[model samples]
Target chain A: MILAIDVGGTKLAAGLVTPDGHVLETRVAATPQDADAERLWKALEELIAPMPEAEGVGVGCGGPMIWPDGRVSPLNIPGWRDFPLRERLAASFPGRTVRVHNDAVCLAAAEHWLGAGRGHANMLGMVVSTGVGGGLVLGGRLVNGGTGNAGHIGHVVVEPGGPLCGCGGRGCLEAVARGPALVAWAQEQGWSPGHGPLDGGPYEEGRAVTGRGLASDALRGDPVARAAMARAGRALGLAIASATHLCDLDVVTVGGGLSQAGAPLFGPLEEALRAHARMDFARRLRVVPAALGQSAGLVGAAALILAGDRYWDAI
Target chain B: MILAIDVGGTKLAAGLVTPDGHVLETRVAATPQDADAERLWKALEELIAPMPEAEGVGVGCGGPMIWPDGRVSPLNIPGWRDFPLRERLAASFPGRTVRVHNDAVCLAAAEHWLGAGRGHANMLGMVVSTGVGGGLVLGGRLVNGGTGNAGHIGHVVVEPGGPLCGCGGRGCLEAVARGPALVAWAQEQGWSPGHGPLDGGPYEEGRAVTGRGLASDALRGDPVARAAMARAGRALGLAIASATHLCDLDVVTVGGGLSQAGAPLFGPLEEALRAHARMDFARRLRVVPAALGQSAGLVGAAALILAGDRYWDAI
Candidate 1:
């Protein structure tokens, strides 16, 4: 068994996953606000207390956190600069091994081992949730760049004159298709968003106003929602097409809340992909819905610890 | 000795390269116009006639070409769709071994074996000439994607709101910083471009106007040229940063005509890279100039054959 922890800004999830893709048990908790080292350590212990025995611990977090040093400073979490996440996990688990990777990268590993991208040697797993992120597994190994941030697909630009991204770049794939940005785009188009803009309400109280909401509205024949989803699909298709062109990837597995809308998103995405992909081989690149869903991160983290040094280096 | 052939849109270069990085003899010829199966075969024969005896043939060409089928259809070289380039070479040299790959991929191989990226396990070789292109060498082996197009970095978007590219994408790295695009951007800024736009006179020949030209003008205090070079550098930096973020490459070797500008481009490129790169390990990634210059393709082609089957799946 392996202990897998998925750390996010809003919540924390930890699980014990067996070798055969089974989730033995999971623990969940609200992520403490301004999680300093002490608070985070407590939260981690609370989540790991009831887990089954493990060989090691695997951590999945936001951003390209440090690998060799085992520190992390996720943008979404305040006061986390150089947080010793790996050290903390090692201390918590004692003598076993511990490995950490970006949440998206773990997602890719999970997808490759047990999800939509199973059996594919080169796969890209994209998470189209509140924010856009992804992981890449090429030549049967995970891709972990120098900063351990190899799969930051959200930052890639899809439109030259579309919208401004959080990274200060204009028209990045994130800026165009991320949930908040999608809602913002709808507002800019003179449409009233069902959940208002992401900026309003209590900071943590605001709900995601894209995807499912848009899907419902489209079902009700709301033209704006239909158009918004279409726009999101087009942007996503363009970004995926670009990835296909550059990496020659075999499969793209898309997941997260946005994917719950199913064909409403994939339909237009496929059409847009057909429109944008230039070469014959690129046209043949596969795009599929993710299988493991929310459990992907936890399972992937387990996989990281189980695979050991050779696989970790490949990653 | 190994026979190396660099096949391009307008020219073909053949060389006899020994194991120790020596080019014993070289041959060059214009690529046949309106090339058919027979014409291309005849042209290859003419180019190879004067070269020294070789044990095997290695070829580098513009791609999205298929390795499994040995077919080629480069963007600039029309009428080559599904053409069996390797079969022809095999037929000509019956007892000799033959291998083929994307030109940029070959460059990466050359960089690993004999150039600036030598000794690195994970490397990227970028060609910033007529169009931006690249190849990857990971774990000291080449990374050939599904159809030998794994390193087509030119299509990656540096600025989501920049310009149009020949591949029909907006704001691709190629659109903002390739030789022709750099000159076009300079002209659009109201500068009297020494090189004409893509369709005007001899300057329209496309590949001639590189970042080096802008660097020369920058040295002369030409504001537009200075800005053009800056943009090119930033674009290149973003691309490298993204590659580092995703590939965990330790070294990046830049080649082609534009890379000749040296520090004028490198300085700003480094600055832009610093801004986008992940903090940890970002500082460790090194960007260097290619040492092999024009001979990279030929040298890399030979290296491709040397590396053998472990990397065959990638190309």
Candidate 2:
């Protein structure tokens, strides 16, 4: 069995996974937003304490980390800037092997190993929730680039001089298409969550103006919400087309909140992708929804130990 | 020793190279335009007939070909669509190894092995001539994608709804920044080659309006020509920034005609790259002119045999 941990800005999850990737036991806890590094460590320890003994431990954490050594400083998780994640895990696990990688990269591993990207030798697995991120599987293996941030498609410039990105760039794919960004754009266009055409009474009260709310509203035929989805989708298509052409990709699997908007999002995405991805080899590419859901990060973390040959090459 | 061949739309070249990438002998001839496939093959045979025998032969040819098997159908070379290049070479040289790959990929290998990209583990080598093309080296090896067209950066979309490309896409890097495209844009902007501010008498008379002429004009303070250079340079920068972020690239080496425009091209390129490649990891990337000159393809083809461990893997 492998101990798999997923560390995100909003939550911490730990799972005991079998050699074949099945999660036998799991634990979860809300991340302390303003906690100190030690406090964050304690929360993770408590979350994993109930898990059974395992042959190895694998972790999927947020990025800008020192790969292999695994010192993390995720943008959203301000509490753990440059935290020694891999060192702490190694010290705690003793003789067991410890592996750490970016959560987005883990998602790619899971999809390529057993989900949407399965059987595809060249695939890009993406997430479009709070932030747009991705992992690349090329020639049937993970592409661990110079800094282990190979498939960071979110930062790819989709619209030059369009919008300023959190990374300090203008018009990054993430700036235009990330969940929060899309919701913010919708709100700017006068979209209020519970004030949509389908919103009726008490059930819609106190609903947060989240990407989920925007997706729901779009599904209910809200004009501004649908437009928001279309805008995000077109940006995604442009970035994916660029990636497909540059990498000669075969398939793209999109996950995360905005992707669940279905046709309202995918329709524009498909149209833009077909329009932009015009190369002969690129024409063979297919973009689809990611099959693995919320547990994808844990499953992919487990893959670090169970299928190291393809996913875990950093160490 | 190795026999290296470079096939392109305008010219065919053959060289005898030592194991260390030195071109010991070379022969070049203009490609027989409008000729049949067999006639083209005869021209290639005559070009290499005088060269000494070698242990192996390697070739770098224009792309849109079936890799490894090397059936070439280069878009610019209409005489030989899907011509069996590898088969013909193998038959011509029995008991010897013959390898084939895209010419741009060869340039990448050459740069990585012996030119500007030397010592860089992750690099992108680009050519910005009549048509833009590129090859990627990641983790110190060539990235041969699903269809063996991994690093074709020409088709990467830099502008949304910008310009129509020969590939039927709008805003492709090639469409906006390739030699002919940039030259055409300059002409459309009322800048005629040899009619620039510095053009004088017979020295500039009858000069063809080409990418080179435009570059010369730009260097001599031609406003429209400079604008065209800046336009192409900015597009190159955007595409390179996108590529750097996506691949976590360490360096980019640009070759070909337009790259020789020097400051008129590189200044805007550097500025735009900094504007978009804002990620901490991506900040370290360096863009430079390719070190090898006209013989890059020949040297890279030689590397296929001389440095097979890093450059040749298909067969």
By DockQ thresholds, what CAPRI class is model 1? acceptable
TM-scores for every candidate against the unseen true structure: 0.84, 0.96
Q: Please provide TM-scores computed only on chain A for all of the candidate models, following their numbering.
A: 0.90, 0.95
Model 2 interface RMSD, in angstroms? 0.7
lDDT of each: 0.75, 0.89
lDDT of 2 by residue, A225-275 (tens): 899999988999999999998998989999977777888999999999999
| lDDT, candidate 1, B108-186, per-residue tens | 7888788898878778888887878888876666777666678777876666445766776566788888877777788
Q: Which ranges of candidate 1 are over 4 A from the true structure?
A: A79-81, A91-95, A159-164, A184-221, A306-311, B34-36, B49-53, B76-81, B91-96, B157-171, B175-245, B248-251, B261-287, B309-315
Report the interface RMSD that candidate 1 achieves against the true structure, in angstroms.
3.1
Candidate 2 on B1-315: residue-level lDDT in tens?
899999999899999998889998889999999999999999999998776478899999998899889999988899999999999988888899999999999999999999999999899999998889999988888888888898879999998988999999999999999988998889888988864333231234554667777877788778998899999999999999999989999999999878867899999999999999998889999999999988999999888888988887674
What are the clashing pairs of model 1? A145-B248, A146-B248, A149-B245, A150-B245, A150-B246, A160-B160, A160-B161, B144-B314
Report lDDT (Cα) of residue A11, candidate 1: 83
C-alpha lDDT (0 to 100) for residue A29 of candidate 2: 98
